[model samples]
Target: MACGPEGDFARSCVPSITTSGHRVTLLTDDGVRIEAAHTPRIPGPEGPYAPSRAPFPAPSADLAVVLAHGFSGSLERPALRRTAAALSQHADVITFSFRGHGGSGGRSTVGDREIHDLTAAVRWARSLGHRTIATVGFSMGGSVVLRQAALHGRRAAVAGPGEHGERTDAWPDAVVAVSAPARWYYRGTAPMRRLHWVVTRPTGRLVSRLGLRTRIHPEEWAAIPLSPTEAVPLIAPTPLLLVHGDRDPYFPVDHPRMLWAAADPATAELWLEPGFGHAENAAGPELLDRIGRWIARRARRTD
Candidate 1:
């Protein structure tokens, strides 16, 4: 049930401060500039999208998590920082941008191509010596993480099942999706429809024209390998967790509710907050504690 060697590289942990001890750089892969940064707990948060600290010396800090931001958002969100701060005890964490969002390359694939970006980042995380990785995603980032799990499986094999075609030994032992939209295509959506129109037409067009690929992927990306909703089944038996607020208006809890319902009973979980929204953990401690505990439980399971 554990991830393979690839998973071992990703499960390493080191305490990191978002502000300092980190420097931003870009790694090139297949002609793409993946924005990357590294920080130690000594360096604290300075600017937006700066990376979090890895557990120093790796594999020594106990555990680690990788955090991906929501659409139109960066790692600077207060909810994220607060949660990261609280979860620091579990492992060293990393926060990253998707392709064009924040400080990365390419344009958003609307959860289409960014999954590639997430996969590549995980590869990088695994290489750093992580053992049990817990992917915590918000909104679209949540979708990206889920898609990565469903499609490519986990980069690390020591953590969980990595049965996807790649057959990596390492994989994420635990997965958390917060306020994530389960079925985007099934939409008779008002907000997403309106939001889609806004981004795809004027905003998307404007940014696309400017050569700025933010949330929407460029037209050149004609074929995508998978859809976020399609990858739901593959996450089973991997300790999948879903958290959403009742008041979440972005993509109704009904979506995540359905996701939890559809997920494999043996490997999935859902937590619906009474008055949370798109991301209530942004300002709340209780949610952070819940997330931390889930991550800790998964890491200890391997121990």
Candidate 2:
């Protein structure tokens, strides 16, 4: 019992829990193939708790939320499945495997090239005719969402073409980044140090491939991409929510604080949870429900 692919499969085998969804294939701008899954929202219970006011509401036809999982995670991960299930209460949810995770093609460049993965997912969401869209990311994925939002912001909208050719209205209406690091090359924490070893050493890469089912690219960044703190400033106008747990082992509260300080107060909100741990695993139903409500409100306003 560890929570690897097999563990996820075993859990899904239980008669009570069903983790089925529509599977998809996506092509990144660089021509990498990404595996994805889409789950329509589950309607809330009727009666006393109205759908509109319920913690989990009926799905909105106009809104869809793209979920970005942490490193070593895929759409099949139980934690990610739980996250997607919770968000599906309000809007349709699309979860995808990043470049080198699960069945996706190409090797992971950690967080650098993962932006394209997210971009492709968002574009797919748009193509489905969703009038509003949001992105919620955890851990390494948290940084990707921030960078993606900034890179596609109105100010930098024309910086480059999207997965296809069009670049207009390709960004998200709201963003939620949980347990994201503020800067690059952070090895202050033990977990991050172990993660660096996994990404930096050949033996570590082999271990990741065999043990964690993740394939890591064995090259250094050609140039440093924008950090989360650096990207936060450009997300203005669009709503941003930063959620970090005080008890997280990979990153301390200072990381979220840095992102908050760099963001525009008019549109950015930060939540520092007390007992929460890290990423999708630590995000419980209550927290996820709250996030869903926030996205519903923010996306409605943006629309």
Candidate 3:
């Protein structure tokens, strides 16, 4: 098993770190193809460490972490790669590009249909024989994680109907959302206002395509889908961590506060870091390692 330099598989484990990760193409329920990379964890000579908190049990050896990038970001992005490198120290890492971001098919629905993309990634992680899986999302990807968790919970809650058969096999074990917006269509901040223009205006869309290399769908949202605040309550019983920078330029502190309020305090943990920016950019090596340990601790829990 080969691995990257910063990856745990590199040191004291494998002799030569040549060919490491494999590519996985997941077809979402909506028929969109998502490109993903699966980097399996390589155990070191030291073995797994016990959790700092006793509440969480020791995680399984087959634990996996799925990384979801923000808008205009992909698996190849430097920020995402840095995050993956840090997380790779604790567990196996899986990174993917949401639709319209990288090599994935279909235009970005911003946060609406992107749930399919996340679901597909989680499902793919499970298919690889990983008993425990954790999802970590940044920015737009963060909203997608919340919605995906809620969608799975909603399905499980309403599994009696004809179309809504039981989908217990589809849900992830843990979730982390960084710099996610609690409400939709928020134009409070200047950055958000500019982002809205880029997403809603024709000239901005053209610039997004040519300059950012991201394709946004022309169709408008029919109705406000379940907002992140609305979705948080449904994610109860599943471990959730909401991380936000107090200095985020896009969404203010209120966004994370709203999400924290909506989520069940018993199962949710919120981290409001000072002087941090937004998403992957703000997540430094120490922060990423801390996040990795947080997820690893929960992933180990059997109850």
What lDDT tens digits, residue by residue, belong to model 2 across residues 182-285? Answer: 99999999999999999999999999999989999999999898899989998888899999999999999999999999999999999999999999999999
How close is each model in CA RMSD to the real structure? 7.1, 7.9, 8.0
Of candidate 2, the 10-residue stretch with the lowest lDDT total is: 9-18
Give the candidates in order of lDDT, highest first: 2, 3, 1
Better of 2 and 3 by lDDT: 2
Which candidate model has the greater TM-score, 1 or 3? 3
| Cα lDDT, all candidates | 0.62, 0.83, 0.79
For all candidates, the clash counts are 46, 0, 1
Superposed Cα deviation of residue 24, candidate 1 (Å): 4.8
The regions of model 1 sitting more than 4 angstroms off are 1-21, 24-30, 37-61, 77-79, 154-170, 186-189, 207-215, 280-283
Q: Which ten residues in a row have the lowest lDDT in candidate 1?
A: 6-15
Candidate 1 per-residue C-alpha lDDT over 31-93 given as tens digits, one digit per residue, 9 for 90 to 100: 344554333322235522234444233333245677777776555546666666666645666
| Candidate 2 residue pairs in clash (backbone atoms < 3 Å) | none
Return the lDDT, model 2, position 138.
97
Residues 1-303 of candidate 3: C-alpha lDDT, one tens digit per residue: 222343221111122122445665566767687787765555557856532232212334478898989999988788998898889888888888989988888998899888878877776676656788888999999998887777675344455322233244557778899999999999999999999999999999999889888999989987777889988998877889999998999999999999999999988999999899999977999899899899989866732
